[model samples]
Target chain A: MRKREPRVILSFPATVDAMSMESYSAAHGVPGRLIPLPTAISAGCGMCWCAPITDREAVERAARDAGLRVSGVHEMML
Target chain B: MIYLDNAATTLHKPPQVIEAVAEAMRSSGNPARGAHGSSLQASRTVYGARAKIAALFHCPRPDHVVFTSNVTEALNTAINGLIRPGDHVITTDLEHNSVLRPLYRLAAERDVALDFVPADRRGNLDYAMFSQLMRPNTRAIVCTHASNLTGNLVDLRQVSAAARAGGALLIVDAAQTAGCLPIDMEALGIDVLCFTGHKGLMGPQGTGGLCVRAGVEIAPLKVGGTGVQSYSPTQPAEYPTRLEAGTLNAHGIAGLSAAVDYLNEIGIPAIHEKETALMRRFLRGVRDIPGVTVYGDFSGDRAAIVALNIRDYDSGEVSDALAQDYGIATRPGAHCAPRMHRALGTEQQGAVRFSFSWYNTEAETDQAIRAVRELAEE
Candidate 1:
């Protein structure tokens, strides 16, 4: 197994919305995938878009271009 | 079995619909909950379903289409969310329990004044009577787009005009007619359109929703987490989240979207033509059977459902005989529209309904007609 590292995640208001974000990004060829909201980040019903820390700014810009809502974006260790 | 209880639930779903549901479950995740590819795919599936539903219903805002477990739940949300204590509302005999029971509870608990515009024995509404019943404080007019018991279509334009003049919101239960009939909510001046996916839309069970017109504010029936606003103590005040609480039946909606896609490809008028032609064939076959009686005003547009009776036979007995003896399946009794049954004087014997769909063939309709003929002769 490979060593793990903290990755950037974008939490959303609702699960459907998080999925919407992912869809827009993929359509625009942006780099990211949706994952279950990290439990350490206050237990809630939400999903986040995760990508490389290096891609954070690019992903944020993609989200803005696609007009998707972002709850919060954070980088935390796995 | 020659299934004819479509008013209860459509048994024959298009193959694409069945596959789409399975595909969604296999490929998607709890959308909006993740930043991963699977979750993103799920989110897209949900959005696709919402957009398709909105387009089909001609709802201006796709976000206003809120998913519920079924039409019953959607109707409850519409009724309880909109009607307040001391408010006046109107309905009619041509409604399923989904529409009537909520109003009944609201009338009992909230002291909401309720009035029903009576229907003639033929399941025909006197639109003029609706004019007489309108009042200044009437908050909503909740009724069915088509009668589940008799297959009669209401003149929604006339009903909406009444609702508009009286300053009441028109909430239509489209359970019986959503897929078969064309429902342009804005063009019809409808405030709230509630529907189930299984009946006309041809999706699986547990899929239904409401299309809220832009400015019509219906209160949220349930409040909880809406993935986006986790910090908020109450449900978020947006379109879908304001009404939708908890993980939606994403799997079922996936199926609903596929069904909508199929409907769009085939066109509603083609589906209507096929189903109605079958209905006419069955009706003509059942005619001249000595003791057979048909109910409802078959004068204009209607669903593919036909309610009938064979002289003095218990409706259940007739349905059972058809099922066991003829390998035909049908629904008997009041069909959850007890008031309509009463109006048709089917209080004691009830009625046997033979509903049709695109999957049904002319041969099956003929078989059912023959079965009823045999039963009538007995």
Candidate 2:
């Protein structure tokens, strides 16, 4: 088994929103990548923006600045 | 063959569009279905297309862009989804059957009341009738940006103003105008702009969509898997996901993305200028021919299309002569615009429609004009 670490996950209502989050992050140098929406967040099958716990503030700021419709921000160990 | 049936579908597409479609077919997977590389690639391509389409139409929100199989589907989605029972809908006689049929069905099945702004013999819409037709319960004004048969451009500014004053949603069918006309949906205050990729956009036939204004909540026409919200019984109440229920035509959308890129590179105004110039060249040559009677008002800005007939000859016969002897392709018959044909008094004889595109040159236009002149002389 791999070691677990604290992470931040940004979820969105739609795939387009998640795609927008991914695009904004790539363009603006935000530290995150798209991952499968954590089942615990919701039972929905979608993608979410997952970032390191240390960069949670940066992620939140980017989401707000980009005017992204983020549904939830969760902290968990992965 | 000299293909002049561009109002039906653009025969000449950007090389990038073809390559993108081919590449996508080889590599893409079901978008939003998984986090795999192929799925992600498809998702990215689709989102890229959505963003590009939103920008092209000047729609404020990219997420509001919803992909349908074609503009017909998009229009159906908009009309059938947003309109409620007993809602009063306004349309124009210049609309293609795509718009007319849906409204007709709703009137038949849902008790929706429909009013039409009339067209003149020259195919010009009576802008004043929009205000005259306004009702207290007017739910929407659905109109085409241009007539597919006569090519007369609808003044969205006038229509949008009437729609706004009446507090009705303005849904435009841009089948003949998108990517060929300068459309700023945001500036035009269009509530929903439905477009097809195959015609003016110069993309594949199966790809087209609608750009919804931020607050317009159009219910889904078809409800199924959206690849997201799989656990929910109801389709998620998101703009695109709400309208887009099934797996999208990702391959065609990739091509559409490239098509938009090409349009941006060349600029739509430049292409429009070229096409209209060709259209004018053809009009000048053929309009003066003896026994030729042209349809539509050409005194103002219009699409690069000219519909005419040689004397009382059947439009199909003339079109056949142009095709067989001259090798020039044009559309004949009613062109699926029965109301416009009736207005033009061509319901019996129909009309031959020659539409130009950015790829058409002066030489081709001249040849088409010569063919029409000779046909008229016969």
Q: After superposition, how far is residue A78 of candidate 2 from its true place, in Å?
A: 1.4
Per-candidate TM equals 0.89, 0.99
Interface RMSD of each: 3.3, 1.1
Alpha-carbon DockQ of candidate 1: 0.36
- DockQ each candidate and list the results: 0.36, 0.79
Indicate the residue-level lDDT of B308 in model 2. Answer: 95
What are the fnat scores of the candidates, in the order listed?
0.57, 0.78
Residue-wise C-alpha lDDT for candidate 2, range B215-238, written one tens digit per residue? 898988999998787888899898
lDDT of 1 by residue, B110-214 (tens): 999988988888989889877798888899899999999899999999999999888889999999999998899999999999999999899989999999998
Clash statistics: count for each candidate: 22, 0
Docking class of 2: medium
lDDT of 1: 0.86
